[model samples]
Target chain A: MTPVLQIKNLQVSYYTDAGRARALDGVDLTLTAGEKLGLVGESGSGKSTMALAMMRMIKPPGRIEGGQVIVDGTDLMTLSEQTMLKARLSKIAYIPQGAMNSLNPVTRIGAQMVDAIKAHDEGSSRADIDRRCKLALESVDLSSSVFKMYAHELSGGMKQRACIAISILLKPKVIIADEPTSALDVVTQRQVMETIDRVQKQIGAAVILIGHDMGLMAQFVDKVAVMYTGRIMELSSVRDMFTDPKHPYAQALIRSLPNLENKGVFNGIPGMAPALLQLPGGCAFHPRCSKVMENCKTQRPPSTNISGGRILECHLYSEKA
Target chain B: MIKLIIRRLLFLITVIWAASTIVFFIPRISQKNPVRERFATLAISGGFSPKDLEVIIASYNTKFGLDKPLFEQYTDYLSSISRFDLGVSYNKYPRTVLELIMDSLPWTIVLLLVTTVLSFVIGNLLGAIAAWPRAPRWLRTFATPFILLQGVPPVLMGVLLLFFIGFKLKLAPLGGAYSTGVIPDWSSLTFIWDVVWHQILPGLALLLGSVGGWTLSMRGMGITIQGEDYVNFAEHKGLGGYTIFKDYYLRNALLPQATGLALALGGVVVSAIVIESQFGLPGIGRVLDAAIRSNDFLVIYGVVLFVTIAVATLMVLMEFIYPLLDPRIRNE
Candidate 1:
């Protein structure tokens, strides 16, 4: 099966007051057609940075430093800004973070959705556009009357649904949803996720679900990649990653998930990730890893595929063994 | 809305009446007595009769009914205000306070209203361009120099421009709307030409410094509005550039500034006293300046009251008009 989106050795950096800071470093990932991949990382782990770099949405003082983000077959980094804008809304839709504030407050919800569809397809008739807009809203379980209501009048969940509906209306080949449920309550989060899942199947599109919640990712994504310190620590099938995580950082992350029975008690990963401007000499996570060896301190680990179709960047599993 | 407007009007009327009454009493109730001043003037002129002066003063006071209760005095003041008879000029030879003000009122309104509105419109447009991201380099460069031009005082600007453009160049008349030989005509075209010709110097002086501040304000407002989340959301929704600027940014920013401008209208007219005097223009400002210098209390009081009422009424109108511009402010 041909991969729908292929990001090869991508690096994103920002020029801050201090100096140049690498946000995402050499990220290599792929998603096959109709595949759902979960990008699980804490804030500042370059998850959103990677997604924004793909869309060329990084404002100046921040830019994609190196490598390519190949969406379908076209290399996005090579495309001009104007062309990229066309690709952005039409081919690969982005449901940005803070979806509630994403719609214009003065305009009615329905007009904005139709505008999005019209922006991508100029030749589409007004009647067809209106029909698609109503269908899109209905698909998200929102009332058709919501189209008539202004943005401020809609509830937070409804706004999120409206944004999602607008993003997916064009039936883009790939959807990059950056924390679509982070601002929502638990129940609303579930509904939004279920909507995304249903839309993914209906459109038969690839999706990159980037968020910090691992348990939520497990419920829907076909694969999961745990990232830390601007690097992918582990990539595996969702079931395997949860069952037996090899990377020590991945293990610590899974152990940190709160237990339902003991609500008050939680195990959190010890120590902070290394600063991007000052990454450790070798393995960035060595200081935080429990099984850190002498070799792990001064040498970066190469990503090696292990048994059970799991890939890990750790010195624990040797090729000789 | 009707009740709100009515309440505002009533409140404004009460305030104006109170202010006018206070002004009326300043020469009488204050330690600098009008009686003493009158006596001093008579004595200086070699006229003798303290007893005769006292009787005359008493009679005069009684005739005006100043010996009555304060509330009764206030009622009389209100009655006189309603009739547009704000008493006679204490110093001007044979003119009532109303007559003096009426002569200059038209000139003041024409100068102030025309210049203020023109500056506001022009400055705001330039400001929007300066704030627009895609605005060409020429606009950005021009705005800087224009702001520098704004810093010059209007009086200085008036003197310089009057000397260069009027005296040296002889491009326009030095002062007044028409030549001495020409009679004032009732024709609409000639009347407009007369008004425009008389307004040239004062208008240019006012525009010189004021437009800069207006431009700066509009530009600042544009920048601030551009940063608002709604503007970005508008862009993301693919709104046309001009429409976004007009409805989203300009409309919201212009609301409060428009109110400030309206409230300033009366003050602008009153405050142009120096400019009018310098140009020899027959406006209320020039007349008010002369009245104050001559201690013409009645004329001074009348001009003050007229200005106070005009400003207050404008403010009330602004309050009523605000809701139509900003939907969020409606009913609040």
Candidate 2:
């Protein structure tokens, strides 16, 4: 079946005074309907950039160099801005990071939600919109009175849940959540993640969960993709990624997670990810990989399918499968 | 909200009382006393004997309440304020301070109200437009002239406008609320038209002088709000450009501008002074100038008290209404 969202060889870069930073070098991601894909990466790894690029919401200085963001069957890159705006909430919705603060402070929640709905469907009546808004709030376990309240009146967790409700209000085919719970407490994070999970399932929408926490991603997502220096290092099922991560960066990420089963000092990856402006020649992760070969430094590692749908991009994995 | 209004009302009353007390004592504490100054002018005219002059001076002092003890005078002043009695003008005897102020107040109110609202609307609209992402290069270029205009003092602007537009081009009347011979009749369009025509230069001067600061401030605020995450979310929600501009961006950006309007309203009296004096309009500022030169204590105190109460009332109203405009402050 055709994927709900297919991003092919996406290239996005930020033009700064220093240099052109390759935010998304050559990202290729596909999310089928009802699929939950977690994009795991450290800061500056371009995970958030990919999310923004998917939504076509990249700000100035950050340009979509070349790419095809095909949602359902339509090529979003080819659509005009007017059409793209219409496509945004109806075709795909984005629940941005820092969801707590991502709301117009002066407007009431219901009014803002109605604005979102009416932006695409101007024919929606006030009564109908109000009903839908209350329904959306109720689905997130929020009281209907939250509709009358302003964004600042709500707690952080409520704000986040309100953001979730808004994203799924239209039941878009795909929802890109960029670090939705990173700013939340552990318990609130779980609750938010569960709400996202339940809403995604109920609406049958594909989700791209962008985050740096491997443990949380493992618990939340169906598939995991490890990214480093604007490239995906590994893509596999959550179970396989947790048990046997092929890529060196993925392995380091799993090792860094504090394991209660084995009490020991957590070992983090050595050195930082290469600057996007001046990436190392060949595999970007080679500098931090312990099992780095000479070829890993000189030649870019190509993705090789291991088994089932598992894929790895590393010189060491070349001879293993 | 009612509680907030009541609290603000109480605060406003206190502020107005304090300002009134200060204004009431200013002429008293000054080296030149109104009664003595009048007596000096009379003495300079040189037509009276010393004994006769002393009797006239004592009677003048009693009539003006200057003969009373200081404490009794203060109580009398306070009581007069409660009764809305501002006292007779020191220079224009037989004419009360209230009558003089009433005659000039309408002209100043018209000039100030028109110029302020016009500048506010034009400035904020221009600022919002300039800050829009798709704003044309020419629209952004609008900022340069406004920024330069903001740096130019209101007096200079008034003078320049008076010279170029009023004198050189002769496009508008230079001074007064109306022509010298025109009767002040509301029923006649010609008279009303002449009044509006007379205000053009002064109004333009005020508008051009003040529009820049509002434009600059609103532009800065607009640019900041554009970068906010909610704006991005609004865009992602497929909000149309106008909806996002009006609801998300402009609504959030206008909070600071609203606060600015309140503060600007407070400065209206001060701004009017320079503009009014420049245009030679029969406003409170022109009256104030004459009052200052002649040491008209009652007129001075009354005008200051009026301005103080107006500003205090505006601030109190803004303090109560601000939360309604910006829900973020509602709980606080």
Per-candidate TM-score against the hidden true structure: 0.81, 0.95
Which model scores highest in DockQ?
2
lDDT of candidate 1 over A33-80, digit per residue (tens) = 799989987778899888778777676688888888888899989997
- For candidate 1, the share of real interface contacts preserved is 0.15
Summarize candidate 1's per-residue lDDT along B202-268 as a digit string, tens digits. 7888887787887888888888877775565455444456656776677666766787688658658
In model 2, the Cα lDDT at residue A101 comes to: 73
lDDT of 2 at B179: 91
lDDT of 2 by residue, A147-182 (tens): 998888888889999999999889999999999998
CA error at residue B301 for candidate 1, angstroms: 4.5
Candidate 1 ranges with C-alpha deviation above 4 Å = A32-34, A114-132, A200-202, A261-266, A294-299, A303-311, A315-321, B1-73, B83-103, B122-138, B141-175, B178-201, B212-227, B234-259, B294-306
Q: Pick the candidate with the highest TM-score.
A: 2
> In order, what lDDT does every prediction score?
0.79, 0.87
Clashing pairs in 1: none
Q: Per-residue CA lDDT of candidate 2, range B1-332, in tens?
A: 67866887788889878988887777677756676677677777874346676677778889998888877988898888878899999888889999999999999999999899999998998888788886788877786687789898888988898888888998888787789887899999988898899999889889988888889988999899998999889988998888888888988899989988988987988888888888778899988888887788779878998898898888877877888898777665
